[model samples]
Target: MAKNASKGASRIRVGVGGWTYEPWRNNFYPAGWPHARELEYAAGKLTAIEINGTYYSTQKPASFAKWRDDTPDDFVFSMKASRYSTNRRELATAGESIERFIGSGISELGKKLGPIVWQFMPTKRFEPEDFEAFLALLPHRVDGLALRHVVDVRHPSFKVPEFIALLRQYKTGVVYADTDEYPSFADITSDLVYARLMRSQADVDTGYGASSLDRWAQAAKTWAAGGEPADAPRVTSTPAPDTPRDVFIYFISGAKERAPAAALALLQRLL
Candidate 1:
């Protein structure tokens, strides 16, 4: 979650994975900017932000409230369920950890809370029963608020129709990572599209060149229209709906400082 941009009847957001990085001061942030205003500054540039602080540990209610109050009313935050829940040895037994994360002031974001990203470890392969059990533990609602979940299964072994089917069964999205290092699954299992743009190059001024950003913008449109892109990587041969769907896109990791530029470029192309 970062900033939410709307074009016509579509909901498409372009942003980076997280804020508060030092490299951004020289690139994305203004020189000599106050550290406390980083989120405020970044929110003005992008449509949304994926909150990385929650991934490392549970954040306080005050932090969540402050974040919501600082950004624009339309700005959103997609948060990763803590590492303690996803990076554990037993995937099926993380209910308490998941509960702790869900209970910890997430409702403070209110309507601005986007999807809850559950990023599995790369070493974790497809164990259908075990995985389903873990998915079952994810709450559909927290404090009467709806929760959207996106699963980031990194292992190549997860590239199967069954895996996509399972996510569809639970209405959980599968992350589409546009990088060679991670598994690329573009199936639209849920009502929303979650993409992690991890291939930004540091050599270029914009993390991704103009042509690449154009293609991504087009893909975002396809996803927004509830259709799949012809050129996108697929986990299943099936197609998604032909109705409008919400889309959340992130320029994450690689060439970290240049990610904001890539995201903004994509946003501009969408506009």
Candidate 2:
């Protein structure tokens, strides 16, 4: 049971959050600069990046094209939907806004738009009426688009089984996060997985620490197994033995300096 499962399944892409800096670890980049070449050099080491910057502002098409030109063909990009669309619970009413966002990326990002993550704040409560209405509207929301949808609910109250079931019902990808803010790597319900491993406070800046790479690697292996399990277990000690699959892993580090280092550590362990 502990053997490798994703042997022949598919390869997963590993990446870090944005190319920006935070005060948490001195500074990610130099004193005053956001260089595309530098970002591309760093991104080349990974397969994808989670564009959190778009959460605060709209993405320009020219900028998107530049990013595409900077990165390799295998590289993928995942963008978080704006706060107005997600945190405001405007899902039922953000149709036109969502369309604009998608339109801006269609030509630039093209096939590289991995997922549009709707990261909800912890304060928000899951009102079934509002939630169901939102879910019901998803299919029609992306009617003509080619991108997949992903949700990352940070509130502990949103971890119920039914919430996840709803994700699978719509063929949406659940953000498999490793965080203390909520449960650690909650059971996922879909085959097309979108995940991020945030550093837990209990972990060291380096080594295996508390990043949950082991769990993810194991899960990826298990998922690589041909037959789906009757149900996902509370925890996995060993993932099933199967071929490898095309897995995508993103590391959104709370500790700045350790972001790339931690990502490399997991990559070494995984590949």
Query: Which candidate leads the pack in lDDT?
Result: 1
For model 1, how does the per-residue alpha-carbon lDDT over 1-271 read when each residue is reduced to its tens digit? Answer: 2235475566998889888898999568888999999999999989999998888987999999999999998898998889999898778999999999999999999999999999888998998998999999999998889999999988889998999999989999888998999889888898999999898898999999888888888888888987888978887788877889999999998888899889888887876
lDDT per model, in order? 0.89, 0.62
Q: Can you give the lDDT of residue 21 in candidate 1?
A: 91
Name the runs in model 1 displaced over 4 angstroms.
Answer: 1-4
Q: Go through the candidates in order and give the clash count of each.
A: 8, 18
lDDT for each residue of candidate 2 in 199-262, tens digit (9 for 90 to 100): 6332465524744666656665555453333444333333322333245567776665567666
